[model samples]
Target: MTLANGGDNIGIYTPSFAIRSAHEIIVIAVVFVVMTALWCFVAHAIVNHPKLGSPIRRCGHRVTPFVLVGLGVLILYQAGSFGLLLGRSGF
Candidate 1:
């Protein structure tokens, strides 16, 4: 079996793989949980802030579409699709 990183498998699959990876999995899980909790807390605080919340609520609808479009363009550029499109168009 090929490893997730694309390395050649060095030995037969065994319980040792799970044992060796358990700690890494646990650490990743803990970090995910902590980050999610922190994000929730920060978002709640921001939404409840007197000075900041109203402006965000008012502008969020107007700004979100542009932000999402920008993010999509960024992703396409990173994936080289923008270059492909430009090349096809003789840019």
Candidate 2:
């Protein structure tokens, strides 16, 4: 059975939207990758800097993994949303 709101069984439908042209998928992927990398870089800097703001470094270390996981989830959700838009539009 399928769970509510999760859409675990949903297939790739193509009858609603077109988030962008086929080329847009590549752009979307690149954007997501770059954003994720940028976030990681900043987070790394925060966790690695010296003296000031360094006390939270440990906390940053503790939360960085979770933060990365959350970012990953967000990226995945965006990807799904994009696909949904394309699928909805019957593209």
Candidate 3:
């Protein structure tokens, strides 16, 4: 996922900078590693944190895992829309 978006963004703007292929590969590798680390952190937080589950039961429909998931979806939607703008603007 990061690769598709990152590669498109990089390929668009890096042409003027004349960046090398190796550098582009390095950037993608770093992005992949960072994204992996973040995934691990979020997964661990949701799985190991008992408080996260407590809110769902204690608060009924007002508080549930879907709320947290929705927040993540919102964030991703913003990122994707921003990326689309960048892609179209070629910046």
Highest-scoring model, lDDT: 1
- Clash counts for the predictions, in order: 0, 9, 0
**Candidate 1 lDDT by residue in tens digits, 1-91:** 1245342222222322443477866785687689978988997899789999999888889997797567656555544555556786221
Q: What TM-score does model 3 achieve against the real structure? A: 0.31
1 or 3: which has the higher lDDT?
A: 1
Sort order, TM-score high to low: 1, 2, 3
TM-score to native of every candidate shown = 0.50, 0.36, 0.31
Decide which is better by lDDT, 1 or 2.
1
After superposing candidate 1 on the true structure, give the runs of residues whose Cα lies further than 4 Å from its correct spot: 1-38, 88-91
Give the lDDT of residue 82 in candidate 1. Answer: 50
In order, candidate lDDTs are 0.61, 0.55, 0.58
Among the numbered candidates, top TM-score falls to: 1
Candidate structures ordered by lDDT, highest first: 1, 3, 2
Q: How much does candidate 1 score in TM-score?
A: 0.50
Worst 10 residues of 3 by lDDT: 11-20
lDDT of 2 by residue, 1-91 (tens): 1234253223321221233576866786688689978987986887677864578854657876797567555654544654555676221
